[model samples]
Target: MASFGWKRKIGEKVSKATSQQFEAEAADDKDLADDDEANWVHATKRRKEILLEDCVKKSKELKDEGANLAENKRYREAIHKWDEALQLTPEDATLYEMKSQVLMSLHEMFPAVHAAEMAVQRNPRSWDAWQTLGRAQLGLGEIALVGKQTRV
Candidate 1:
């Protein structure tokens, strides 16, 4: 019974040692893999660029339709079309600017300000966005001063 107990203990130690050694080798392989030059984040960025390109065409079509509606002074329908275009490409600064224009036509100064702000945030380099934001701010200020007798 004593000899049998010793054999079982030795078998467990051997199995544990083997497992540890295998795990150590696997870790070493992972360390080597960490040095690989094929950085995957750039690949992901490229894929995102491709997806953005695909969205561009459809979003532009919706935007053009919205523009025609806006030209006809159909502001509400234009807003709906703009909303769908934005859903297709939410990152588009131009869309936000257009929506801000429609909101201004509706005299919804607060919402126009919000939309213009979104356009600026999406593309700070866009002069149109900055201009729209400035206009919205002016409109809001005018409403507060003249309509509401407010300070802000």
Candidate 2:
């Protein structure tokens, strides 16, 4: 898991303040407190959610920029922008799928295949990711066959 230091601190502060307020409100009622395990899980989830929102916001901006670049046929520049987005949201399967498509267009068979594999691993149910992987594999096979034919 990626270290989200600031996100965790902010989340903890919010949770602590909220908990204290709730405690004060319930002081006279004597309500039972949540167990340690539940508190820990809730804190962890809140921290993760905050970090995910931040990354998603940043990554979406970069992905949109990459899409515009790709529309202009600037494949390499688009790939660079997508690469930046991936650093922010490494598990975004769409980024991986799109990056592999650009790599395939650039005839980077191995890297295309690798990116597609990452997409598949990130989201096994994503048909777009599977499609990109299939295209890369097919392209690589075709290239190998052509090479063999020339050698013979």
Candidate 3:
């Protein structure tokens, strides 16, 4: 009877120690995973930020070159430069607006309208885009579409 009691006590002690070791290991693993996740997230965010900065810088350079070309009356070259800028910033309403004006200078009515429409779509609240769209529509001989007379 005494021997049975001693054995039971030893068995309980061993089980408790094993459980504590497993708990400690689990905690360490969780800490490692959390650190790894945090590092990965931070790196990804920084990489995206760097890429956006680069794109904005390059787009600006292209836009400036295009504006200079347009000012010099090199309409086709200006259009080409603006097109490259658009590739970097497709959602830029100003780029589309500039392209629309260049196309108008070239008497490309269809393309001008298309570019103006794209500008309007990208910036619905922009007065310049709306004005460009109206002008392009008028140039395309869509005077009826631009306005209609109503009896007062």
Best by lDDT: 3
Off by over 4 Å in 1: 1-53, 142-152
Clashing pairs in 2: none
Using lDDT as the measure, what is the rank order of every candidate, best first?
3, 2, 1
The Cα RMSD of model 3 versus the native structure comes to: 7.8
Locate the minimum summed-lDDT window of 10 residues in model 2: 28-37
Per-residue accuracy of model 2 over 83-109 as CA lDDT, tens digit each: 999999888999999999999989999
> In candidate 1, what are the lDDT values of residues 1-152, reduced to their tens digit?
44544334545557877988988999998876775434566677889999888888889999999999999999999999999999988998999999998999999999999999899899988888877877787887754433332222
Pairs of residues at least 3 apart in sequence or in different chains that clash in candidate 1: none
- The model with the greater lDDT, 1 or 2, is 2
Off by over 4 Å in 3: 1-37, 148-152
Instruction: Tell me the tens digit of each residue's lDDT in model 3 across 47-130.
Output: 999999899899999999999999999999999999998998899999999999999999999999999999989998888988
Q: Where does candidate 2 stray beyond 4 Å?
A: 1-51, 142-152
Each prediction's TM-score versus the true structure = 0.59, 0.61, 0.73
